[model samples]
Target: MLDRLDKEFAFGREALDVRAYRQELLSSNIANADTPGYKARDVEFSSALAGALKQNGTASNSSTLKMAQPVSLSTSSSLAVTSQGHMSGTSTLAASGGSTDDYGKLAYRVPSQPSLDGNTVDLDAERVQFADNALHFEAGMTVLSSQIKSMLSAITSNS
Candidate 1:
């Protein structure tokens, strides 16, 4: 059924989303390379993907895969309430953006060499990471395409 297709394609879809998010982070790092005190940031891809899938119950139970809601790393919430006090007043919300529970959360990168300006971005490293992520994103697309073709072929031949 279509539900099965959803489950089957979920991994590829999720991987693609994560890859795109990583690309964005890397691009930001590259763009801010010259900004004083701007720390380079990146997600731990595999762990982030795993965490996202787990949140959706996709990674743990194939039986529940069809019911699982999709989770995207790139579009995750950056702002959240710090306490009930924030929710008490309608005028303004006291929120925090430093949650460790964030899916595909960005982590500060360690520079190979320290800079006097306190910037942690290494242009060479960010560029290399960006290139690698772009390659993986394309590769994920290819795999997804293959899966779709196989599914379509099966359906057409059956009909």
Candidate 2:
């Protein structure tokens, strides 16, 4: 059934979503690299993925999930506003892995050197991270495609 397929491929689906979120975050950092007071942000992908699995009780490896860094902030709590007049447009990092709002947990990257503008984005680091993530994302896609193909082949053979 569809549920069986979901159980088999949920991790892949979640991973792809996570990777896309990361790509957006990295792209944002790169876009703001030249802007003043922009802080480079990245997420703990492994941890976020683990948290999600734990939430669903479908995690194959609980020990590895524990190794993932804790998501310190919850989007719901941060979104709570005291009054209608209060300004609350700050894009907060959602605790990745469990919630629907998992836009890669926004942790500020420490700057290699202090900038006069207080911008923390390091172009070189962002570039490397972006490329690495993209490559990994592609790898995940390849594996998922193979799995789907094999499943379809088995179905056709049985029929």
Please give the distance, in angstroms, between residue 78's alpha carbon in candidate 1 and its true position after superposition: 17
| Number of the top-ranking candidate, with lDDT as the measure | 2
Which lDDT value does model 1 have at 103?
51
Residue lDDT tens for model 2, 1-159: 655676778788778767877888899999999999988888878986666666655575332222223446544534557998987754565444445344335688989986899999999989999999999999999999999999989989955
- Candidate 1 lDDT score at position 79: 46
lDDT of 1 by residue, 1-159 (tens): 766777788787667767777787799899998899999999988997787677666787554333323442343335457987664333432212112243556799988997899999999988889999999999999999999999879879956
In candidate 2 the C-alpha lDDT for residue 94 amounts to 49
Worst 10 residues of 1 by lDDT: 91-100
- In model 2, which regions exceed 4 Å deviation? 60-104
How well does each candidate superpose onto the true structure, as a TM-score?
0.74, 0.72
List runs of model 1 lying over 4 Å from the truth: 62-102
Each prediction's total of clashing residue pairs, residues at least 3 apart in sequence or on different chains, is: 0, 1
